[model samples]
Target: MMRQKHNFVAGGIAAAALVALMGLAGCSTTAGVETTGKTSWDEQGARILEKNVVFNSSSLKGDLQIVDLRGVQAGDIMRAQATLRSRDKDTLQFQYRFDWYDAGGLEINSGAGSWKPLLLTGRETKTVQGVAPDPRAKEFKLKIREME
Candidate 1:
């Protein structure tokens, strides 16, 4: 009887773990979200050249919000700032990376950018900033994803 009960409990634990793993697998998407900010100049002055927001994960789209994205020149290198807000009532762990592009829409380092950790509390608003890898970078794309 004791051996049977032990086996039953172990089986239950394994089953529960498997279910959790399956649920997470369904939500697993590395794509996360992406937003771009660029600078443009003409006769007037510097202006927001382009802005694009893309969501690759539906779950992340519902939990994370991008309030504002802006880009400016810090000396020769371009800097980017993004305002992010958490919609859920729980703290979240995420990773963010910045990709730099030149004036002709070419990526600076391609896949060289490293993912940085970001922690956002419930209903908290935070601004994250990134600096271009080189002076030729005129546009920046910010990507956010759940901690893997």
Candidate 2:
């Protein structure tokens, strides 16, 4: 009787663990409840130029700026403005790219390639803009590269 009882308890615990593991396997990071109503630009976009960019904190001796980001939506047009400043009085040239991702955390390939070049004055700032090809995109990331 004692051995039978122990076997039954072990079986029950194993069953519970399997159920839990299955539930976790089905969970996803990107899939979730989405906004149904009209979404505003502020909710979708950010003034990263004004808030996030900072001047020289180290020996880099350069400043970064963002001017504007507009017309943002889950899967629509997006824009941004940026500026670069250098105290060394040297001209700076750089390249930039934008990437879009969906709610499921999957990257959407626009096939446009991913690099654009710009020239800036020692204390000048520039504006950049981008658009999403589809409406399913919910997140975006911007990448900057210094020209070699």
For candidate 2, the per-residue lDDT at 123 reads 67
- Over 4 Å off in model 2, which ranges? 1-63, 67-71, 74-88, 110-112
Q: After superposition, how far is residue 142 of candidate 1 from its true place, in Å?
A: 0.5
TM-score of each: 0.82, 0.48
Residue range 1-148, candidate 1, lDDT tens digits: 9999999999999999999999998886666999998888877784665889999988889899999998887889888999999998999999999999999999998999899999999999999999999899988999999897
Q: What's the lDDT for all of these models?
A: 0.91, 0.50
The alpha-carbon lDDT assigned to residue 106 of candidate 1 equals 97
lDDT of 2: 0.50
Best by TM-score: 1
Runs of candidate 1 exceeding 4 Å displacement: 1-29, 42-45
Clashing pairs for predicted structure model 2, backbone only: 49-66, 67-81, 82-126, 83-125
Candidate 2 residue-wise lDDT, 32-76, digit = tens: 111111123365585222123222223333334444343343334
